[model samples]
Target: MELSRRIKSLPRYLFAELDRKKQALRQQGRELIDLSIGDPDLPTPQGIIDKMSEEIRDPRNHRYPDYEGLLEFREAVASWYWRRFGVSLDPSTEVMALIGSKEGIAHLPLAFVDPGDYVFVPDPGYPVYRASTILSGGIPYTLPLREERGFLPDLRDVPSEVAARAKVLFLNYPNNPTGATATREFFREAVAFAREYDLIVCHDAAYSELYFESPPPSFLSVEGAKDVGVEFHSLSKTFRMTGWRIGFVVGNAAVLSGLGRVKTNVDSGVFNAIQRTSIWVLQGNMDGEVEGWRQELRRRRDVMVEGLRSLGFKVEPPKATFYLWLKVPEGYTSRDFAERLLEAGVVVTPGVGFGEWGEGYVRMALTVTEGQLREALRRLREVKL
Candidate 1:
C-alpha cells in the first residue's frame, strides 16, 4: 500500500529510534543507564493520584468530555496561571485543555499554517514543532539557538522577507534538550517581532515550573503579548504527571478558538476524570510538594554536571529542565560520541536527531536516579573517548 505523503515524509521519531538501539543493547545483556529521554523518574504526587482515584469511580465521567474541557478545569487553569505567572486569562475564551501539551503543539500548525507558509522554529528545538509543521504542509524556517547567545533565537537575524511570509513563531523556554530559560525581555522582543510580521506566537512553556533558581517568566506576562499569541503549558514536568496527559493553552482568544475548532473534529477531549483531578491539583496547595520535587531534580542535575565536568566535558548545570546539552568531544561527531557511549552501556540522545544545526552536541537527560547517574558516570570514566 502506498503511504500518505505526510506519513512518508516524517522521520522516525527521535526517541523511537533511541529505543531500538537500547533494545539491541539489552538483547546483548547490557544493563544500560538510559539518559536519552526526559521522562521524570519521580511518581506523580500522591494527592493527585488520590484525587484521580476518587474521580474515576464516578460514572458521570464515563462519557464524552466537553470539547474545550470542563468549565471548572478551565477556571482552575486560569487561577493557576494567575497565581503562578501573574497572567490573567478568561476561562471561557482564553483557555483550552489539551490531552497533553504535545497534542496541542502538534495540532497548532494546522490551525494557522497553510501549504508553503513559513513557521519560525528554533533549531535544536523540541522535534514536534518542526514535524507538525511538515505534516500541515508548512515550511519550517530554522532559527539557530547558538550557545554564545544563551540558546535564545535571534529575532533580528530573521530576514524581512521570511518574516513577511511566516504564519507562526514557536518558542520554548526552559527549553527541551538545551534546558535554556527565557527572560521577559527576550519575550518582549519576540512579541514585537511577531506583531511586525502579523504572525501567531506559540510559546511552549512546558518546563516553566522546573527551574533551579529564579522562576521563568511567561510570554503572556509581557504587555500586549496576549494580543499576539498563546502559551502551551503541561502538568507533566511540573507535577511529574507525564502519564496523565493533561495540559492547556492560554492567550489570544481567537487563536485558541482556531485550535479548538481543529481539535473538535480530530479528537475527543482529555478524559473527564483526569480533568477533574487536574482541577483539584491546580486549586489545592501543592507548592511545597512541587518544590520538593524540584529539589530532588536539582540534586540529580548537580551529580550529572559534576560527573561530566570531572571527565573534562565542560557542561553547565541548566537553570531549568532535566537536560544537559553537551558538546561532543574533540574528535567525535554527535552521533559518533553517542555510539561510543552506547557501547559503554549508557544511552544518550544525539543532538543531530533534533536538527542539522544540532550536529555537534548530544543531550543527556537527568531523568534517572542519582545512583544510576553515578553508574553511568562510572561507565563513562572507563571509555577512552
Candidate 2:
C-alpha cells in the first residue's frame, strides 16, 4: 500500500492550496473576495451553446469518437490558425484535437521525455510543465523569468551541456502568472535555439485570444517555426468555452504524429458533439465578440492596476492575458503578502507558489466583475504591506 513516488513528489496544487485557505476563512464566517484562479466568470457565447445543444440531441454524438479527432474539427482548427496567425497547417498530418490545452500540455512530456532526460522549463511557469516532467521521471532545468527581461526566458543562459541533454523546451504567451507576451524576434530566437539543440518546442498559446491592445502573435507565425515546434491553441479562453474542454495542437507532422499516437493509447478523443460545436465556433468570424471581451478585460485590468498603484503598490497594466503580477512590498515574501491579503479577506495567488524565481510577487486574475474587483481593492486597503 505504498503511494507512488510520482504522487509523493508533487507539491500541493496551486489552486487547491488557495481553496483550502478560502474554506478556512469561510468557516470563520469572513466575507471573502477571491481573485485567485484564472477560471473566467464570463458566460459561454450563445452561438457555441446553441450549437452544442443541437448536436447533443443527436444520438450520433453519444458514441465514442475518433481517437485523433473528427476531420471536420481538425479542418476548422487549421482554418482558425490560418485566419488568426497566417500559419497554414495540414489537418490530416499536423493537427490533433485535445481535451484541453492542459491535457495536451501534461501528456506531451510523456510522449517524448525519457527517464532522467532534461527539459528546459520556465520557472514561475504553469505548474503542469514541471509536474509533467517530474511525472515522466525527467529533470526540469529552470529558466528564470525576471521582470527586467520582460519576463521572457533567457535562452542564452542555458549551458551548452544542458541544451545537448534536453529533449523539449516548453514556452507560453501571453504567459499565465506573469502575463507577459513574447515578440516575433523572441520566438525566432527560440526556434533557432531549438534547432541548434534538436529538441521539441511546445508553445502554449492559450491566452493568445485574450490580448488587451492587439492580438498576440503565434509562434508558428515566425519563419521555420513549424519545422521545430508545435503551437497549442485553446477554444476555452478564446470563446469563453473553458468547461467545453476543446483545443488543438498544430505544427511539425512528426511531432504531432507522436503526440497523437500517445493520445490514441490514452483515451478516446473529445466528444464528437463537442467537436461539432468547436467547428461552429472556429468557422464564425470571432473578432467582434472577442474584441468585446478584450475591452471588458481591459476595463477590469485598468481598475485593478490603477487601484493597486493608488495604494502605493507598483504594477503595470499587462498588455495581454487576464492576470496582474504585483511585486510584494519590501521585507514581505510572496506567500507572506498573499497570506496577509487573505487574512484581510482578499484572495490572490502567491508568486512563490509558481517557483523559486517568483519569490517577490503575487498574481491576481481579472476573472471577476468590476464591482468585485473594486471591492477586492477595498479589502486590500486594509493591508499596509
Instruction: List model 1 lDDT by residue over 1-385, tens digit each.
Output: 9989987777676556556777898998889988987889878888888888999999988899987999999999999999988999999999999999999999999988999999999999999999999999999999999999999999999899999999999999989879999989999999899999999999999999999999999999999999999999999989899988989999999999999989999989999999998898888567888899899999999998999999998888999998999999988988888989998999989999888778899999988999999999999999997
Clash count, one per candidate: 0, 0
TM-score list, all predictions? 0.97, 0.97
lDDT of 2 by residue, 227-339 (tens): 99998889888788889888888999988888887898997999999999888878875567787888899999999999999999889899899999999999998887888
Query: In model 1, where do residues sit more than 4 Å from their true spots?
Result: 12-21
- Give the C-alpha lDDT of model 1: 0.92
lDDT scores in order: 0.92, 0.89
